[model samples]
Target: MSWTCHLDETDVQEYVGRVLGTGYTVADVTKMHGGAQKVVYKIHCRNGFACVLYVWDLTKNYFQEEIANERVHERSFGGHSFETNNRWLRNHGISTPALYDLHTGQDRYPFDYALVECIEGQKAEAYFKDPDQRVRDEVLERIGSMIERMHANHRQGYGKPDQSGNPRERCHLVQLENAKEQLSYIVLHNGSIRKNHDRLLAVLHELESRIDSRKRYGFIHGELGPDHVLVTDRLEPYLIDIEGAQFFDIEHEHTFLELRFGKHYRYFQQNGLDPNRMLFYRLHHYISLTSGGLKLLHRGFPDQVFASNLADYHARNTLRFMEEWQLDN
Candidate 1:
C-alpha cells in the first residue's frame, strides 16, 4: 500500500511557475528537515522572494494505511494550521509568514498543499552555543510565553483560575486511541515491541484518568518539539510543521519543552525556568515516542544514537510513571 502522490511529477516546476507565479524557477529541491510525509523545500524562486513549498505524499509514513484512516479524514490539517497562524498574526500581533498561494487537487488526488512566504532567519536550535546566559534566558522565556499564548487561545476567556484544571479534548483522545489501536497491530505479534508499547499504554491510561477528572478543556498543540519552533535573528519565534497538530491535553506539549530545555535545567534554573510541567508532558512524550519506536522497530531501527535514546527514554518514562502516581486498586 504505497501512496501515489498526486503531484504531477512532470509538471511540478512548470506548475510552480504558472500556478503560484513566476520566479519560482525551482532554485533547487532540497529535502526538508524531519520526516517524509510532506516533502518540505525552501524553493528559491527566480524572483527575489523565497517561498517554502510543502508537497504532501499520500503514501508517506504517517499517511500509511495502518493509522491515517483513523485520523486522516481532514486532508488539510497542515493548511488549516497555516491559516490559524495567518489569523493569529492578523489578530494577535504576531508575525507569521504571509501565505502566498494555495494548491489543492481534490479532482486528482484529494490532497492539498500551499506555497507560503518564507521568513528569513536562523533556527532557534542554532543558538544553543551562545555565550550569553542572559540572552539565552530571554529567548527561552520568550518561547515559553509564546506557548502560553497558544494554550490561552485553546482556553479562550479562561482566567488565571482556569489554567490548572482543563481536561483533555476529545479529538486528542481519539488520536491517542488511534495510536494505541494501530500500534497494537505490531505489539501483539512482536514481543519486544509489545512489551515497551504496553508499558507506555499503561501510563497513558492512568494519565487519561487524571485528565478526566478535570472540568475544563483547551486546545493543545499536541506536538511542540523544538524542531517545530523557529527563532529568527531578532529573537522572534515562528512555529512551523504543524500538520500533526491537534487539540489535546495542553500539558502534552510540555514534555518536549522540558526535554529540550531540561537537558540544561540546572543552568536554566538561575533564569527562572521551571520544570514543573514535566509530568503530563512526559505522558504524551511516552505515547508519541512509543508509537514511533514500534514503527521503527519494524523498519529496522535507526542509528544506534536514536535507537539508544528511544530505548532509554521509553524505559525511564515507564518506570517514572509508576513511581510518580498511584493507580486505582
Candidate 2:
C-alpha cells in the first residue's frame, strides 16, 4: 500500500524558502531510496548546501507495525535526532552522513528535507555480487571493519540511551512486543497458510525467555541487511538507512550479520575479527533466522531456499546457542 514520490525542483525551492526565509532557494532535490518504512530525499540548497528529508507515512487507515506515526516516530524519533546521532557516529569515526538541518518543523513544507552531507559509495550488495574474489574479500574486510567501528562507537555511547526511559531499551521492548503481536496475525492476516501454530507459539515463548535473560543488552540497528551498508569509492564503509534503528536483543543483530555473510567467515577471519564472537553470532544468527520470530520478515524473502536453509540452520543451532550461551538454559 506504499508509493514512491519524486519531488520537483520547484517543490524544493519553496520548501527551503518557507523554512529558511525568502532569500534562500533549493538547488536540487534527489531521491535516495532504501528504507521500507519511509522515503528519504537528499537536498541541496542554493549556497553550497546539502541535506536529507525523512518522510513518514501517515495516510493509512490502519496504523500497523512500522506504519503508524507513533511507531515511525519511535523508529526515527525525528530528523533532528537522526542528524545528531549520525553526526555523533561520524565524529567517532563511524563514517555516517554529516548533519545539516533536520525537518523537525517542516509541516509548512510538504516534502521534508534535512540538510546533510552526501556519502560517496556503492551499496554493500555489490561487494558480494562482484565477480572478482580478491575484490570481494577486500570489500568484505572493509565491511567487517566498518561494522566493528560502528559497534565500538555504539559501545562508546554514540547511540546509547539514558532514561528519557532509555531510548535503546524502550526501542528493544517495542520491537519484541511488535513481533509477538504480529505472530498472532498469522491466522487473521496471512492468506490461508497454517502449520504448527502451537510450535510457532512455543518458539515465541523461547525467544522471549532468551531475550529476557539479558534485557539490558545494548543498542541494535533493529533492522540489518546488505542494503544498510554503503561502501565508498575510497573503500570506506558506512551505515545508512537507519529508519528502523532500535534497541533489540543482541542475538538478532548477530543473526542478521551471520545470515548475510556466514559462509564467508573464512575470509572474515583474515580480516582480523575474533572467530569465537563471529561463530557465536553466526550460530545465533541461524537461531535468529529460523526461529518463529522471523516469520514476519520472511514474506519478502524470495524462494524456499532461503527460508528452508534458515529453518534447518536454526534447528542445528538451537541446542548449540542455548547450551553454550546458557540462554534460558
Scored by TM-score, the top model is: 1
Give the winner by lDDT: 1
Q: What is the lDDT of residue 157 in candidate 1?
A: 22
lDDT of 1: 0.54
TM-score of each: 0.71, 0.64
TM-score of 1: 0.71
Q: All candidates' lDDT scores?
A: 0.54, 0.52
Candidate 2 lDDT, 264-321, residue by residue in tens? 6343333433333344344434434444424534545333565556555555554455
Spell out the clash pairs found in candidate 1: 3-59, 23-46, 23-47, 167-216
Candidate 2 runs further than 4 Å off: 1-11, 14-30, 42-53, 60-74, 110-112, 153-176, 189-193, 210-212, 246-248, 265-329
**Predicted structure 2, TM vs. truth:** 0.64
The ten-residue window of minimal lDDT in model 2 covers 154-163
